[model samples]
Structure formats: structure tokens, C-alpha cells
Target chain A: MQIRPLYDRVIVKRIEAQRTTASGIVIPDSAAEKPEQGEIVAVGSGRLLQDGTLRPLQLEVGDRVLFGKYAGQTVKVDGEELLVMREEDVMGVLEADAGTTRKAA
Target chain B: MQIRPLYDRVIVKRIEAQRTTASGIVIPDSAAEKPEQGEIVAVGSGRLLQDGTLRPLQLEVGDRVLFGKYAGQTVKVDGEELLVMREEDVMGVLEADAGTTRKAA
Candidate 1:
């Protein structure tokens, strides 16, 4: 089963915290109030204008993005936890470095 | 000097509450927590889509609308207090009765 967001909403899967210091000290997920990073899994068609016109969303699926820590709603879809939020809630996209391929597990 | 809101923002002047009961009891402005009514004074061109397209606003000048009590920010323009909010914050337009003229004072 798959989920589709409606009207500029997007489904995102959060990237788990897995960072370590030069000394190999791993940082905990609940350590800071910084923005959370996620990968867009699904995207809505667009926003519905008052005149019935549809304005397409700017973000696309597979895009890495940053969002507020408390943004969007968490829902369990197909037994997998995902976040649903409007495109406006996304801060910006994260560009991957050259030759680096990071795929969600 | 008139203020022009940017993007989908709108400037509105609140309609003072001055309703009277059938028994001639004047209801004070602080009576209820109902939605506030206001008249649109100015509107932005439209929302800026991700692709740089501008979506025109559904509202227009002189439109009577209902909004939340704390929906928008209040500012003093030319010494007259006004509200500035995005078009999305407006709940809906209030249509005037047939042959009835209600203008903000």
C-alpha cells in the first residue's frame, strides 16, 4: 500500500541521526533543537488556487530537505513512520556532494 | 500614504462591533470570541509559486471577510490601525444582503 499527499503536501522519511566526532563520539538524536533532515518520498500535485487553478509544488520526490523540528504530522503508513507537511514547511533542499550516493535504508 | 502588501498579503481595516439586541441592548465589542469581520483595503498581486509564477489572489479590495481574532499582525498605517495577513488566513467572504449597503466607517 502507498500513500499520496494532497495539494502541496509531501511525505518524508526522516534520516536517522548517525554523526560522530573526530574522536568517534556519536551524537544522540535528542541532543539539540536543530532542524531535522529528511528525504521526500512522495509529493502532492499542487496547491489549489482560489480560482480553481492548480499551482504545482516546488519540491520533488527524492529531494533531501531540512525542516523544523516540530513541523508536520507523523503518521504510520504501511507500518513505516512518515511525516506529512505542506511544501511551505520545508526550509530548503540539501545538495549531495559529488560522487556521493546516499540512499535511505 | 497608503501601504501595499507584498505577495499574497492583504491589508484590512477591521469593522467595529456595534450590534444591538432586539430589546435595545447594545452588545459590547468584547462580547464573544467569534471571528472578527474586516474590509479589505489592499491586496497583493498573488502568491509566488516555486516556478516563479504568480497566482492572483481570490480576494479584492472592499471585500468583507471573516478571520480569526489573532490571525494577522496589526500595524498603524497613517495613524489608522490596520491588519496585514496572507490571503490564506482569511476564512471566507461575507456577502452583503440584497439592496443593503454596509460600508466601513
Candidate 2:
């Protein structure tokens, strides 16, 4: 079953932190409390205003974004872990160059 | 000097939790982590939608409301402590009957 977020919410799949250094040193991600990176899988139409008008979200699907480590609600979708959070929880979008540098092969 | 909250933000003056019971037993409110009650001192015009529409706030000055204990930023306005927070941080408005029961002299 597919889950669609409502009203300015978005679905995100976290990109796991790199576990190894370039010099071949293995580092653990669990100990550090840091911002998390994710790719937007789905986005709501927009924010619901009091006047009933929908304000479109600045984010779009497939966008790479950064958010606080503790932001958003975690849900299991088809055995895959995904996050559901409001668009405001997202800090910023990652540019093409920055995102490509961190792309996992 | 009066403080006018920005869009969707409200200024609140917290009502100190009752320090004494009916039987005249004194109690401290610091230990218990609980929702706080406040009176709206000022309100913003409304939420600013992405399209630049300003949706008016539901709250008004003199309205008593409930909010989370940790919600909002504390500021000293005119030597009096006040809170500045978005309207969403408020849980609900306290009706007249309920508000009178806790009214302090």
C-alpha cells in the first residue's frame, strides 16, 4: 500500500550516512547527532490556509533535502522505512553539485 | 512600548499556575511539566500564504488560551515577561466558565 501525505507533508527516504572514510577508516553514524539528508518521494498539494486556499509547497518530488535529525515521523511502508513531515521541517534543498558529490554508488 | 507580533504569531502573557489549593495548602508549579495557560496580548494580521495572501488569526487580544509548557520564545517586553509563538502552538481557547475558575485576583 502506498501512503500519501496530506497538507504540506512529504514522504522522504533517508540516505544512510557514509560509514567509511576516504583513508579506509570505518566510522559509526549512530554516535553523532547531526542533520539528515533525504530524497523527497512524495509531496502534498500544498498548505491548507484558513481561507481554504492551498499554498503550494516549495519542495517537489525527487528533491534532495536536509532536515534536523529528530524531525518527522517514521513509518514503515512495504517494509521500507520512510519519513513523513511537514514541509516546514525541511531546512533546505541540496543543489545539484552538492547532491551529486554525496551520491552513493 | 507595545509589541505587535508578526504574521501568524501571537504575544501571550502566561497566567501563573495556582500555587495554593482550596484547603490553603501551598504547592509549587515548577516540578510538574504541564500545559500552560496564557492571555493573548497581541496578535498578528494572519498567516502569509505562498501567494502572499494574509489569512487572519483566529485569536484576539484578551483571549485565554492553552499551550505547551515548552512552546514559544520568551521575551521581556516593557519589563514584563511575555511569549511569542505561532498560533499553531496554542492548543485551544479557554471558555469563559473555565477561565473564571482560575482567575487570579
Candidate 3:
């Protein structure tokens, strides 16, 4: 199903860790911690507030964001992992200027 | 530490469960599902986007919101469970209708 997040909602595809690391050893899924970040997938239009006004969002798709451990409902689209959440849920987009970058799979 | 969420960031304190329940039998921590929502605490002043302007937030404190599971970072303030997540992380404010009023502890 094509679940479109309306009104400032964003869909994110979480980046999965290729392999588990523990003291330079590889661990299995049964022992690995769930990844807590994701890449933006789909985004929503701005929302209309209480004053009969509209508020625009600053974030865009493809931005990687960090989230709380227990946040966002899980879903899959076209066999891809995804999470549907509000644009506000995105704690912050990780700046690309930092050395931290998404590892290529 | 006072974690002020600037620029549309919101701090949420997850409401905890009073007693467990299941088929009339009380379930313990191991079986109960973690509540995937929280009450708004701190808020950011909204962000300035690429267009060099500011945007306002729509939600407010005391508004219970639903978030995707595995969203936001975990933090504690004054011995209370708090989460510093982006306002965008809030999937939606749970509408207070259809008998979904939270059971008071």
C-alpha cells in the first residue's frame, strides 16, 4: 500500500547495519541492538495550524535523522523497511559536513 | 541537565503504566508493550530553513502525541523519563475522542 504521510508527515527508511560489532567480532541479529536512525523517504506538505494558518517545514527527503529508541511505527513498502512519522519527530538532520557519513551498503 | 530543544524540538515525558494487565491477569515488565507516546515538555523556537526564514510549530506542551517506535533519544531529567526528539518526530497528536482518554494512574 502506498501510505502517503499528509501534512508534514515524513516516511523514513532506516539504514540497517551491515554487520554487528563487538570487540572487533561480528555478532548476529539475536545479539545486535536495533539501529536508531533513518533516511527520509517521503514527506508531507506543510500543516495548517489553529489560527487558520499554514506552517512550512524545513527538512527535506534524503536527510538522515536520529530518533528516540522507542519511536515511530514500523512498516515496509515495496520490500523496503520504512517508518511513517511526523516531520516534527525528526530530532535533527545529521549535517554532512561532519566526518560521519552513511556507510555505503 | 536542562535539555532545551531548540528550533522545533520537543521534550516528552513518557507516561508510565500503573499496573500490568492481560486476560484479567497482570503482566509484568517482560510482557507488557512499551507505551509508544508521550507528553510534550520542552520546545524549540522553530528553525530557519534554506530560504533564510523561520517556521513555527503546531503542537504544544501537555498535548499527548504518538510517535514511531524507535524514535528520539532517551534522556532523564529530575528522575523522570524524558525524550529529546524532534518536533517532526511526533507522528500525530492523538485526538481525544472515541474513548481514547488516557486512564489516570
Mind giving the per-residue lDDT tens digits that candidate 3 earns over B1-105?
A: 344454657777786665545567766645667788788765665554544345656767678889887877775444556777777788978765864665442
Q: For each model in turn, which proportion of the native inter-chain contacts is also found? A: 0.00, 0.00, 0.06
- List RMSD in Å for every model shown: 14.2, 13.1, 12.5
Better model by DockQ, 2 or 3?
3
lDDT of 2 by residue, B1-105 (tens): 889989989999988866677899877767644337789999998888777888776677998765666879999977999999998776445552311121110
Ranking by lDDT: 1, 2, 3
Tell me the tens digit of each residue's lDDT in model 1 across B1-105. Answer: 898999999998998867789999988868944436789999998888777888777678998765667879999978998999998776545553421121211
lDDT of 2: 0.73
DockQ score for model 3, please? 0.05
lDDT of 3 by residue, A1-105 (tens): 677778867788887766745567777655777776678877777655655555665556777676666667888777866888776666655543521222211
- Per-candidate TM-scores read 0.45, 0.45, 0.48
TM of chain B vs. native, candidate 1: 0.78
Worst 10 residues of 1 chain B by lDDT: B96-105
Off by over 4 Å in 1: A1-52, A55-105, B21-35, B97-105
Report every candidate's CA lDDT: 0.73, 0.73, 0.66
Model 2's interface RMSD: 16.9
Chain A TM-score by candidate, in order: 0.77, 0.79, 0.75
